[model samples]
Target: MKKLRVGSVLLAGIVAAGAAWAHGGATGIVKERMDAMSDIGGQMKAVGRMLRAGSYDPALVSSAGATIAGHAGKTLVDLFPEGSLEAPTEASPAIWTDRAKFRAYSDELQEAARAMKQLADRGADMQEVAGAFASLGGTCKTCHEAFRIKK
Candidate 1:
């Protein structure tokens, strides 16, 4: 009986290990996305502070806004799909479990990004673009509050 129990335990460990390996894991991809997102976050914050300080050149805002919209709209959601947040993901599990709400915030961010880019591309007066900028910032804040874990 003792030998049989030991064999059973070893068999269970082997099966668990196989299951884990079959999943293919989330090590490098998660790290890469996290770094990419962190870099974009830094860029977003820098642009916000620069604009708020009344020191940003309009051209810089245009370029940076394009850069931000590009990544935020594309890469952000690509990194947070249902199974994509398995491990090493700073994303909250709520992203998948409460998928509708997660997706709503993601869509909001994408829309804000598109709007920001359109406003920037139009070469609108900075004052006229202020509200759009605020909307863009607000979208990011709303999503962060709901889905992203604070580091």
Candidate 2:
């Protein structure tokens, strides 16, 4: 019975290690997309801080908005070509399977970012800026919920 227990424990350890490796480090296109998404997240956080602080820097907002928009639309969808889901990717297979829906989300992201940038360019007041920022955040949440796999 003791030998049997030891064998079961060893088997469990091996299974757990393999499961962990199933989500291990990505390379190639997967790595590139991860890096790009990280930059977008960082910019979003920076702009979010400015919004929350009520500092209202239109120039800074415009720059960050541009950065986010640059990653939006086709630029984003192109990053995940068919079968690009190497290891360590939290990207859902649904992205490729439901390609059109993913494209729509990407479009929404681009439009929201562009609108926010436009607001900044026009020197909108803080309330208007906040609204635009919120819209951008919503768009991100929508895409992430649908396309980013929970890890």
TM-scores of the models, in the order given? 0.67, 0.82
Which residue pairs collide, candidate 1? none
RMSD of 1: 19.6
Q: Candidates' lDDT values, in order?
A: 0.59, 0.76
C-alpha RMSD by candidate, in order:
19.6, 15.1
What are the runs in model 1 whose C-alpha is more than 4 Å off?
1-27, 81-88
Give the top-scoring candidate (lDDT).
2
Per-residue lDDT over 54-92 for candidate 1, one digit per residue giving the tens place of the 0 to 100 score = 553566657656766666654666766567665545577
In candidate 2, residue 110 scores what lDDT?
Answer: 88
